[model samples]
Target: MTPLLELRGLGVRYKGAVAPALEGVDLDLAAGERLAIIGESGSGKSTLARAVAELLPQTVIQQGTVAWPGLDQKARNGRDIGFVFQDPASSLDPVMPVGDQVAEVAHANLDMDWRAARRLAVELLDRVRLPEPALLAQAYPHQLSGGQKQRVAIAAAIVARPRLLIADEATSALDTIVQAEIMALISALVAEDGMALLFVSHDIALAANLADRVAVFRHGRLVEQAATAELVSQPRTDYSRALLAAHLGLHA
Candidate 1:
């Protein structure tokens, strides 16, 4: 089977930056596979995620090929990829009704008519388990809880049933309980959609919970990657060990 997403010889350097944010990175994820990219701040995890989603700004210099099954770079420009950012509040439009925002995605990418897209929007809200989907649809972003907003974000992302979900620090802003709930919800949604997931986070334990495999990045370079259990139990590099150690201490 063809890979759901592939990156090769990928490198990124922001204008006037001292070093590349990412350098010569390669990753391939198949359909329904869950992969996590974990590293400390400034480790290029977010850059990698944005690059994969093709959401990077033009100011950054980029070198690489992003390959998706049966689609060239031009053809892969739409709904086949969905990106959920760290903060839904920032990503969402405060002025627009959240429902309309969600529906707009379907309208824009899926070519659904307004009425049909709006109808599907409420269904998506219900799918994400949001309360009173109809009422919530009419509400503004500020009216919803952080978790609810994220769910709306998720709902919007999957409204078109994209093949790959790029979650860039998606659950980082939520409270502990809400964070776990969002993670579980996203995991379930990904599985249900058979969408490959590339989850970017600093939380090793959370990644271990949701990912089949994990990739470790350090200073714009991919240092290690393996099955989650193997990487957690037998980290090869000192940095990987340190990351896992801190994660363990957090739970202990």
Candidate 2:
């Protein structure tokens, strides 16, 4: 079977930057497979996500081929890519009711009428296990907690059932309990839909729980990639060892 996402010699650099945020990175994500990218801040993890989604900013220069099944080469927005941003509150509009914001995506992409679109939004919210989907549908971002907002984000991302979902540090802003909840929710959704997942996070333990394979990044370079069990037990690079040690120290 063809891969769901493929990146070859991927590199990104913003205009007038001293160095590229990412360089010479290659990755493949198969349908129903989970891949986690772990690295320190500014290690190009998020950059890789944006590049895959074709959402990089105007000032950035990209050199690579990102092929997705059924992607509209003419209109990049129609591609089968969904994104769950790190900060839920920032990703949502303060004024619009969360449901309406989510419904808009379905309306725009799926061409559903307003009523049907709204119903789909509510259903998605409920699917994410939000309490009182109808009531929450009427609420704004400020009315929801951080965890609830993240749920709403997840709901919106999967509303269209995209083939590939890219979550960039999605659980980092939530409390530990909520983080666990969100991770479980994400995992369940991936299993439910069988969509490919590209998860980017600095939390090794959390990522390990959800990923089949782990790819370690260092200074924008992909230094190591392996199965989660193998990589955790025997990291090939010094950087991977340091990252694993840091995570171990936190719990030790």
Please report the candidate that would top TM-score against the real structure: 1
User: What would the per-residue lDDT of candidate 1 be over residues 48-94, giving only the tens digit for each residue?
Assistant: 98888778899999998877764554424338888899999999999
The runs of at least 3 residues in candidate 1 whose Cα sits more than 4 Å from the true structure, single-residue gaps closed, are 70-78, 250-252
Instruction: Write down the lDDT that model 2 would get.
Output: 0.87
Clashes of 1: 0
TM per prediction: 0.96, 0.95
Residues 137-186 of candidate 2: C-alpha lDDT, one tens digit per residue: 99999999999999999998887787778899999998999999999999
Clashing pairs in 1: none
Candidate 2: misplaced stretches above 4 Å?
69-79, 250-252
At residue 216, what lDDT does model 1 achieve?
97
TM-score of 1: 0.96
Compared with the true structure, model 2 gives a TM-score of 0.95
Clashes of each: 0, 0
